[model samples]
Target chain A: MASGDREESKCCFKEWMTTQEEDLSELFQALTVEPENIDQLKQLAEKSITHFQDYIKRRNKLAHKDISAYFAPNWCSPWENSLLWVAGCRPSLFFRLVYALSGSEVESNLTEFLLGTKEGYLGEVMSSTQLLMINALQSKTISEEERLTMKLAALQEDIADQPIAMIAKGLSKVGEMNGEVEKVLDNHGRQMVKVLEEADGLRMNTLKELVKILSPLQAVDFLVASKKLHLCVHNWGRQRDQKLGRKEIDEEC
Target chain B: MASGDREESKCCFKEWMTTQEEDLSELFQALTVEPENIDQLKQLAEKSITHFQDYIKRRNKLAHKDISAYFAPNWCSPWENSLLWVAGCRPSLFFRLVYALSGSEVESNLTEFLLGTKEGYLGEVMSSTQLLMINALQSKTISEEERLTMKLAALQEDIADQPIAMIAKGLSKVGEMNGEVEKVLDNHGRQMVKVLEEADGLRMNTLKELVKILSPLQAVDFLVASKKLHLCVHNWGRQRDQKLGRKEIDEEC
Candidate 1:
């Protein structure tokens, strides 16, 4: 902690991101192979999910010590940081992506596809039962999100009620701001870590459930969309940061 | 902001850290060369400083958007995060490293070197005037640190007085938690960024000034020590985190 330890963690996460990019490319290649190998496609889908699980596990371990870091990670652009829900994307984002993808496909091929003219595209992507399940999952995720938000609110209040209040009082008393203030802050940090853990758990479970509901080919497509969206957001955010003068333009060169 | 932008920034920093490692090894090689090449050493020293300055510039740009990210950077271990002073190591740390290095040298070679028994051991490393300059720099750094700490303390108080208080009140108002809460938090975030910018500026200035005071050889040696110490701390911290179960041991494997 005293030295470059954080640098090591940063390096580890960077490598993970690189791996994600490579995985995304592999998934894309799998999708385009003309023969349409179901077994290979399914294996790739499961492997992608496993890789994601590994990342979550690694992050969870890091979160235990410094959850606040994840909540406001420096590794992310300020724009991205502003949008973070409990240290990462909201679990409900999965449903939103799914809905958006489905809606767009239907809209583009509306006349032909809905009239039973397009057989493979519509039915193969999602069944009515799958749609219903997704709807339920969305509701469940939202409620869970609300519950976590409330817990976060309580912790935010405690920041004022506990450590901030103690520090304020100690300042007035002319010096004696050591052990007690630290203890309160430490206690707060522990609670914050717990909230983050719960949030991450919710995110992982939601992704797992959604993947389960997806057909193997559908899962691969969804995963591709998710990865692409994530990367796009990151790039877009960086551009925005540059435009806003929050980031240096010359660094890119 | 929404997706993987943080991942990009993390990767950038990880690359920077890797560059530092390579720079450190080159410096060590420079140090060990026989009949030391003063001009080459000076160039290397200056080059290292320039590289560091570039990093600071990049970080400063990022800080404009989300200063809190730097203050609680996720890239670092929680142990390292706990020790951070305004987004990084204290400016005074440079002085401490110098003193530790000098003191250790003096201690190890006391009898032979101090009694005019050894020629190139102590005098070539740190001149009397350089020590005085460093002492003065240390004092100035401490006062500046105190000032920044006070500013940070005020900002912490504002979290309770402004945003937290507003959120608490909004929660009770039945459904009015919209623009005002967001505005208050945004204002607070801006202030936080300014404080981070000022702190980072201080760190960069202190380092530049210290380098200005040292001889080329001394500066190179100091830079090597600093980089070595940083890398060592990072490794040590990771080990400690693993032992504490705050980090995954299997990740290394």
Candidate 2:
């Protein structure tokens, strides 16, 4: 509960983030298609995201002077370790599949600076102009097809295979229901939104990718949840005896 | 989404609970448990307990008007099957165990009625004063040796084998330090001295139980939190030394 201890713990998260930027080392470095192998990489991405969330939660609690909130034996889980796993590994995997991979020195160095490598406090890897310059170069180099392909590939291959990913999705779905529920939980705040948006987007993208594989029932479920298409949901339990079916209706209907 | 649907679903809980109590039928009339077959009893007990917890959680959620809270496509969950399992098999197990060990009611009628053998309704089983009164009499008649030696023996055997239980204990131990922090979270609500007294008793009980297996250091960690013996609890690291070597120091020391 000491302010000194809180300051010390804050250093841990600050240093971790510094390290991740320096090490963007190989974003997309870890995506795979095989079901079993995908789990580990997917887990690493989740861990990275969770670490960021934990960092944010800790930052807020500390800022609010709830410094006595002891987190897991008072362990301030390092946020950068989480990000690094996904940052370089996941982005690199996408580049490998789509665009000729671009691993920027700014991305890597900034990550390391934020996450703090072996050096207790490493050198500044990139300046403000340097970061802006790198962003400009990346913007010029990237194309829409490349972006969409990598994004969809990551969603289908890496994100969906994770168990924690589903929890992230479930939390998101709850948000889609109402913000009051999320606020009442108070246990997890904005992290719920981040996870939900990611899940919602990923679900849409993946379903679109696998539209050919979906049965009529599965399609109905997706459409119902996505569009809040009430009638399709009702039909889930009563599709039988609709033998008078096959007549096409208006698209909205 | 529908207010009427929400109320009706919850009404299902209270309404279903208010059915007629059914007497034990032929299914349980010839029930028996082999003494060495502890595994079967443990499985049945755990299954029933898991189901019971889900039922309680579901009922509470519905009571809070969130009937669809736990809905998944999952049809074979404990929530769906627990009452039937408890009413049908586990209740029989409990009856046999009680009867054989304590000379309590081995009759199927009361067991069936209590377990919902006739009908699976929470209100009926819980509201029946006559059945409760009979069970209370039977429970009181059970000797300490019968309950402790038989019932506790079953629990110990199961608790020993449960990996999750061990992990939960470890997590609880690690989380204990945070309990003090939680108390500090509410300044007006925190009656520190009162908490310290209760913590002392709980610590003493926990310490006595762990004395046989825990290292001296582990025991100290446990007792320290249970008793809220820390001033700041700012840090608890480097458990290099396993022995605390305490010997009732004088107040001056």
Candidate 3:
């Protein structure tokens, strides 16, 4: 990988960790909540944990998948060491959280560990609680690119609260490109985006044409062409994590 | 990355996880011995846990350093995201072991957590016993290459015990241009290790002749060139693991 790729990987690791700590801390708090119905709560938590264990086992396959991808060409043994080193030194934190929550159930988890690699040692966490934790967090997990795309789509929808003519104003001749209609809105829900006050009806017609040609999501991506979704993802993560931390213990992920 | 590299990486991960499970299992057993000792024992374990945490931090930095090295000629976020992606994962087994051991210290280990990562978290387990467990493991952690070399060395040593002088002598002539010595030893001792047999007689002369030519370890490495040190390391691990497990309370690395 190039230097840039390596740097991106590091950033990815850091981000992953931050997310993990939040999940675990939240899990701990839930464990401490003396629920009004202890017996019922225990049953539900146990079930969640079982589900999480399954999720971990699936993710374990990921380690094998990534490393094998790296070693396809030369078939040399030296490179394998790097992947192994990584595995030994740092496993997926998500895996740990699930395993931790499962607590005593870990012993059983080993028997279920099934990866194509058929590696000698790494099974997985045994308990059910840890598994639940894994599943819950994993559901929200998405790559940086995917996360960004999702948010940009959201942002576009947010900006769609405007008249079509007003939203189309930015387009000089967008109809031929995506055959779409525009409905961009200003912060105060004004028609600042769709229609260009200077371009007259020509601008609005072109903008509307562009919007109609593109899918709703595609239109948003095009509208924010020069921008990245990182900021939006981060904002979403913050709000989501807080909600996660405050969630009830027995709720399904 | 190709299919082969990915496969190799996956194998390594599995092996690593296996080793981790084995090691932490040892530590866990150790901590459980004086199960009732609780807080006092936890304080001691905490020393080890703290060390383990430090090791994790340092390991991440070092791993990143390698990526940084690879990217020296090019620059753009240093490929940190990828690095972090791998680094961010936990040695799940290790953390699980830590959390489990804390069970004995129940009240003493339970304490408030502090936030470190912006949106995530990091918190102290409180008990010294937990820290001790972490520290003890860190003290023994070795990188992948060192581990593999050790394993390979041990295998070589085991293989050397077998005798086969004809093969060794034949090896000297066939494609010997590579300067590779294939010393097939006898089950007992013999012609294959002719150099070994002649060593004692030539020992004094050889030392005098090459006193300035080698470092002590290198010399030893050469002497045991056919002996596989890897097996020795593996064996050490097995025996030590057994002892730790049986004892159920070792805090020493």
Candidate 4:
């Protein structure tokens, strides 16, 4: 979270939005392939929406599990803490994409759709760290230091392509110190070092992968389209419920 | 993070939605004071939306600062970690409220509003801890142990308003230990003890304060309305852009 890092992240985020727009436009074009295929397209879109909803719910589960691990002494890392805010954006982003493709159709059922889809996505981005943290907390035979040493080794394997040998070595030495740390306090206590030093690079890589997955569609232009679609459908559903004076619409949430 | 805590939090969220719905309805009734004041109402609403947008931006600054402190060891806490997810819902909640009041009007200026408002509110919830942690890290004279002891003392004062003496005492004792010995640690190593022990109680307190602030408004039922308005306005803007082939609409984000 250095000022330089912040500037880089902001630039990266803008670049991502630009890429998503292009990809979404392509997806929309592909979907419009045959106006005659509209029925099939709607069916497929509905299924995709449902999958997105499930994905959101799973992220909530993951957040809860990860937070559970955090209470255990050594389970949470500083990099993971920094990433939590960004990760929370996933659910809204997912909903935005789905709502965009679904068009401006707002109905009684849309309330159910919005209400049913709950949760966020911090869990997905930090999945590897969360799993390892949870396992370390649960393992009875291994000491916390041993667990950390293993975690560092595992990270080295995961980021083999990245140039993070220094980070790996720093963490490895810290793990080995095992709290008997009067010897090399200066070495271990550098100012706010991030354990996952390459997290931003990894996120940019993931964004690229996501764009690839979202490419090949028609030209709907998701950057603006999806957000507007979300607003329209949301308001439509609200007005419908208001027209009915149905208090129960919101009770389901 | 526990099943029971999740259930309780879910219920609390539902209650919040219901309360918001009631408040929105009241606000709408007040806005139609004479129907002749329609222009003035629109102006006031726009101002309110701008204020909400500023609030969201302030939260982003807070998050960046807090995340920076997260790199400093032991500065962040488990309770703070769990709260980060819930804190992030504030922006969407603010937008939903404004959009609910704004009706279905999707203007060109509104597109800018949608694109301009970006970021969430995780940092606000953990600001107190982040400040204390950063201060602890930077203080030249105070040992880490002394800083922790001071944190425990502050927590005792804060929770004195509640009835959590056991939690306060336990943490205070842990603070005093200063990493002394590592025996009999099983009692303190429950996977999600933080979730049930402090989270529910803390959230309930926060909810009570929020309700107090929101209680005076009249009831037009914003629970579903706000979310729907958000979606409707969002989609309306996007569709407008799509119609214009204005690819630059989303570039601002």
Candidate 5:
């Protein structure tokens, strides 16, 4: 019975793989010729970014799914993995192409477009940073609101003032975790705190440097777009967390 | 017997995982403290780049290994995949950190270090582009020298004049492959050709734009370093290809 169920899932996966391959082939066929002008290039960039965004959404969905889903531990097929690689590579190649063509004049537009992409590289950085912090704390879970607040505090200058205090609070919580963890922090946390403080500065400087390449309005657009994606991811995380909580309650009952 | 072999491989992989995790933990501890000055930051950047380069080398080594080796398709355990992701992410995060702190003065040094990192982003782009071309041709084998010549041609200006002609020859060969293939090409190949041609242009322009941010000497260093890594990957590919070829002959005999 279990083997039969696995076979069914494999068949479905194969069907999905066919559709994805067609999409990829179509993209490759479209790329046979390069765009001759800026307008054409921009269109290509937009298309690529859109496709890339779709893949990211799928990737994130897979990542956060329950253990019983298609990608449970030790169950990811090579075909599925290769598809993910292709999805990732396609958009990246397009992005590099766009970046290459974005001369000084269109640099700002390109920057805005890049940031506006669903959970773009900047957002990835923010999430990764938060993950690093969470790992250091040896925490079990981070709240959706916490993640959103942290991202907002980093991206939105008006609220950037809150991050330091937040960091302090987070550090104190880590200190409270246990004696052993606290001792680890005490031995190394001073430098870690300094790094965290400096990391915020670095983040801000990086954003400023990136935006300096853009016009003022473009810079504003970039930030606005980034904020939107951050909120989106945050909301998604919260929904997932709530669903998991409900499941746990039912299981316990 | 097969299950026993799998168990043996899993054990070896577990040993590798422990060592890698320790390295990662040490890196995190090192990064816990922020560098105090520009000089300190430079040292950090240098050390991080070296480590990143090492990861890239390992990644490349795994990629070119024969199918019978550590990573067989469909045999990738989640643990192995996660390790690959970590290897990729660690270098990228460090590269971004270095980029963030590299003010205009040190930008060149950072850029050179980045390009020198074994199969870094630029190398990734080049390799992807080659893969695209190879896939398009649907050919069984590509010579190592052919691949190396193509990369060197892209990276070196004195020889940059030759790649276009080489690309043209490659396209013509694709055209001659078969009537059905030619028909497919005739139907969709024009755009694909343009994309590849424009891709090369984009690549050159991208390099120029990135190098523009560096000092002239640094720019030269960047190119030189990039060229060196390209050759390294190319040579590795050749050696791997030879091994595979010899194995095939041995099997046939």
Candidate 6:
């Protein structure tokens, strides 16, 4: 890849992050607006989802040539990279967020009113049916993650037995690696890209499914929370990097 | 990390690779040299191991601040990153290399003479005892990989429930994330560094044990093969990257 192309990919991700900040601000506005502007909230929520889809599309294009870049993206902070799975956040995170948000709301209501209520106002944010569906989606997503992880393990193992082995044998005989070795490595790269694509597919599907399960207002709240967490983590990672005496990436770049 | 420091890490790794190339050349020279310099071969093999240990130590220090860089290291090619386990190649890969080299020797001997040979010259490169030991080591390494992978999975899942959830709650209440959120992320980063350290330990131990299991000449052969494979894959990855129109990091830089 050309250095220019690499910079382009980094810029692409940075732009996406900037868009995320904008989306979060808009989401917060929708959440706090008077008269419960349901149409505005719904439109903003859908727009957020569309924006995510577009970002994924752009990422997929870059990943086809350099998927490893995403897996260990230099654009993100070390702290953020440490938590990454398959190049981005885990899809099942949405379920955990729902449970956490609902649980927190319930706890706050109890503390405020001292009532033994089973549910809070926001508790109905997720219906029992929605919870069941989300739970099922979570199970499926987790299992998919496990499957991809094992596949990755196998791929890592193959590194020694396949290309490395062939190259070793060729070197021992001919004093150099042959062209076939390159082909083998390229094949391996293609498989890695496939695993990455599958992972991205799971992430996108999980988000869409979760959004589908929520009411427009609830979805806006969830979106607001999700974006807030993302932006917060990014900023926090930058702060931690600075404290650790690490040079942070230039946001403008 | 500062761009210069990042460049230093890359240079550190590149220097290591240059050493590997030199080592491979020496190993092959040792293999083909007359009078079979056992002392020289053993010294070279030991030096190779020591170099690896030193590299790991240096990497560990860097990882204390930016362990994620190792996991998704830019110093390596995308192909190399695709196969990385815990910031480097899998420890179990050594066992596979032993098996492949031994298996190929056996096959070539069988085909050369059309005789049902019980054991070829290189077939005994690993004795029954050594094979048993290596098998044990492989199992241990694989199980260790599994454990680390599971730990990573848990860590990824915790991202949403721990830091993200807390940040979300804090933002909803106070219109901003609190300092506590950064602490949570810092804690997660520490755990990640620990996991990377464990993986490096496993990799070093596996190499040491495998070397111990082989005769000096056999060890030289194995080392030669290993280094050749390493250099080949790295070069292959770079070529592939170039062919894919990706920007390659300048070698001098």
For this target, which candidate reaches the highest DockQ against the unseen true structure?
6
**Model 2: per-residue Cα lDDT over A1-253, one tens digit each:** 3434444445644454443432222112332122235444345434444444455555544433321122211121111111111111122211121111112223445676788842101112223543354344334333432343334323322211222222222331211323432233232323323333343343333333322223222222222122111111122212211221211111110
How close is every model to the real structure, measured as TM-score? Answer: 0.49, 0.17, 0.19, 0.21, 0.23, 0.83
The alpha-carbon RMSD values of the candidates against the true structure, listed in the order shown, are 18.8, 28.0, 32.2, 27.3, 23.5, 4.4
Task: Please report, in order, the local distance difference test score of every candidate based on alpha carbons.
Answer: 0.63, 0.27, 0.27, 0.29, 0.30, 0.73
Instruction: Please provide, for model 4 over A1-253, each residue's C-alpha lDDT reduced to its tens digit, 9 standing for 90 to 100.
Output: 2223323333433343344434444434434454246444444444434443443343333333222122211222232232232232222232223232322223323654678752211221223544354343324212322343233323222221111211212232211222322122222212112222222223333323332333222112222244233222223323322332322211211
Instruction: State model 6's lDDT.
Output: 0.73
Q: Which ranking of candidates, highest TM-score first? A: 6, 1, 5, 4, 3, 2
In order, the first chain's TM-score in every candidate is 0.87, 0.23, 0.22, 0.25, 0.29, 0.88
**Model 4 per-residue lDDT tens digits across residues B100-214:** 2322223323554668741111121224544354333324212322343233223322221211211222232211222221111112112122222232333333323322222
Instruction: Pick the TM-score winner.
Output: 6
lDDT of 6 by residue, B205-225 (tens): 888888887888778878877
lDDT of 5 by residue, A1-253 (tens): 4333433443444443344434433333333443224344334334433443454344334322211223222223221132122111111121122122222215434566777633112222223443353243322111322342233222212111122212222232221233443333233323323323333333333343444443333333233233222222223222322322311111110
lDDT of 6 at A89: 87
Clashing pairs in 1: A1-B80, A4-B234, A5-B234, A6-B76, A6-B77, A76-B6, A80-B1, A234-B5
DockQ scores for all predicted structures: 0.02, 0.02, 0.01, 0.03, 0.02, 0.36
Maximum-lDDT candidate: 6
Q: What TM-score does structure 6 among the candidates reach?
A: 0.83
Interface RMSD of each: 16.3, 25.9, 29.5, 26.9, 21.4, 4.2
B-chain TM-score, every candidate?
0.87, 0.23, 0.22, 0.24, 0.29, 0.88
**Tens-digit lDDT track of model 6 for A1-253:** 3555667788998898889889987877767753178788778888999999999898788777666667767677766776677778877777777777777776767676676544223454557887788788889989998898788777777877844675655665433436776567567768888888898888888888887878887788788778877776677666656655554443456
- After superposition, candidate 5 runs with Cα above 4 Å error: A1-11, A14-253, B1-55, B67-253
Error of 2 at A92 (Å): 24
True contacts kept of each: 0.03, 0.00, 0.00, 0.06, 0.01, 0.41
Model 2 accuracy (lDDT, Cα) = 0.27
Clash count for each candidate, listed in order shown: 8, 37, 124, 38, 11, 6
